[model samples]
Target: MADTRERDIIHAFVELSNELVDGYDIVDLLSGWTTNCAQLLDVAAAGLLLADGRDVLHVVAASSERTHDLEVFQLQRHQGPCLDCFNTGVAVNVPNLEVEAHRWPDFVRIARSKGFASVHAVPMRLQGTTLGAFGLFGDTPGSLNEDDLALAQALIHVASVAIINERAASDRDVINAQLQHALTGRIVLEQAKGVLANEGNLEMQDAFAVLRRYARDHQRKLTVLADQVVNREVSGQEILRHARFTSIRP
Candidate 1:
């Protein structure tokens, strides 16, 4: 079991490295990163929050709808592990949410109501600059072991680097532009997901998977493809065709 997990971790890193190539879609990359982190770390779910040019946090990606809503709730209330981690540039490990009620009352209440018992948030920082945070949610109360914690931080660090290196620019203006672009792309991607879901009579997650599969198969940037779908430049029927064929493949 341990060896298999080790292989999975290695494979995750390799896939991340491959996606770091020139002109990769930042939103798609981060979405996949959150999903990979949840699976690799054995967490129930994971979410990623990124700061825009104004340093305001936005929910960029999540492994589950419940996780996404929890991340947004933190931003709305301005208190939570991910928010605190982003502000302080330090990890916030809550092995048990019940124990942190006083620290983040609203966040803890909503998270527990959503079936999450613990959360660990790590900063996506490089050097002295903090970008955002990656949050892991568990269904039961317990801390990630030392090695797992280190691995989580490592993954967050790599993701931060990927964001910075996406355009090979280190200037504050360039970085902020990249971040803003990604956030905007996420909005369009969500609209595209709605379109696919309605057109194909599929769930939101499955619609997103179809969008991703179509994007990857056609060697198209996810954000760009989403934009086309939103603009009607790419017909929903064309995308549904791919989705239906893929689903029925033996």
Candidate 2:
């Protein structure tokens, strides 16, 4: 199991590195990242929050719907482990939600109600600036072991580098613009997901998969494709047809 886990982590890093090439989609990259963290780490679910140019946090990706809603709740209340981690540029670990109720009353209550017993959040920082945070949720009350925590931090650091390295590190304006573009793309992606889900009578996850697969098969930027879907420039049925054909190809 340990060997398999090691291979999985290495494979994940290699895939991430490959996706960091020119014209990669930030929204798609981070969405897959949250999924990888949930699968590789000893966690029930994972979520990511990214800051816009204004430094306001937005839910960018999540491994599960419950995790996504939890992250949104945190942003709404403005008090949670993730928010604290982002603000302080450090990790916040809640081994037991019951113990942290006093510290994050609303967040703890909601998290427990959603069947999460513990949570940890690590900052995605480059240099002295924090761009976002990555969150891990566990169903039982316990801390992530030191190795898991270190691995999570390392993954987040790599993701930060991918985002910043898209533009020159010294160009603050370009960095902010890039981050802001990603945040905007996330909104469009959500809209496209909804459109596809309704059109195909599919679940949101399935809808996202179809969208991403079509984007990759066509070598189109995910955000640009999402915009076309949302604006009705590209019909959902067209994407669904391509997805169906792709799935059955010999």
Candidate 3:
């Protein structure tokens, strides 16, 4: 089992590294990191909290539905291991939640209620600056073994490097701002696709094509137009009405 787990982690690294250079989606990359951590590590769940360029942390992804709820609760309370990790630019290893009750009462309470008894937070850092934290949660109250902790740190380091490298290549002024916008754009695009698919009775591919056409016709940024669609400022029917399809020649 240990060998298989190690192989899986290696495979995940290879997959992630392939997208590190260009045209990589930050939201997708971080989301995949959380999912992979939960699967490759012995953790019951995982989540990622990213600080925008201004050092404002946001819950970017969760490994599962319940994990999402716990992460959301942490964000709402503004106190948790991930927050500490990001703020201090160091790992916060909480082997037992019950012991940390006094320091993070709200976080402990909510985490316990959600069936999480332990958490390990690894900082996503480059040089002296930290961009985010990856959270590993377990249902049992015990610390991860040395090997597991080391593996988690390695994965976190790779992810942070990929993100920083992407930011350095962009024209953006700050890492957090750039990452936040990229993540938000992904969310908006997904929402717009769903709206179009349901309203126009179209497949996901068709809905995306319609969205692209509308953005081009209006000379609007695709991400901005997607946000408008999600906000209902632009309707799905409006995009469907303007989309033009062409046949491909064999």
Which candidate ranks first by lDDT, i.e. highest?
1
lDDT by residue (105-209, candidate 3, tens digit) is 999998998899999998887766777788999999998899888888888888777666744734446665567776676567768878988988876656766
Provide the lowest-lDDT 10-residue window in model 2. Answer: 166-175
**How many collisions per candidate?**
0, 0, 3
Runs with alpha carbons beyond 4 Å of true place in candidate 3 = 166-174, 186-250
Q: Using TM-score, rank the candidates from best to worst.
A: 1, 2, 3
lDDT (Cα atoms) of all candidates against the true structure: 0.90, 0.89, 0.77
Q: Top TM-score: which candidate number? A: 1
lDDT value for candidate 2?
A: 0.89
For candidate 3, give the lDDT of residue 158.
Answer: 82
**Predicted structure 1: lDDT:** 0.90
Q: Any residue pairs clashing in model 1, and if so which?
A: none
Tens-place lDDT digits, model 2, residues 46-107: 99998987889999999887898899999999999999999988888888999988998999
| Clash number for candidate 3 | 3
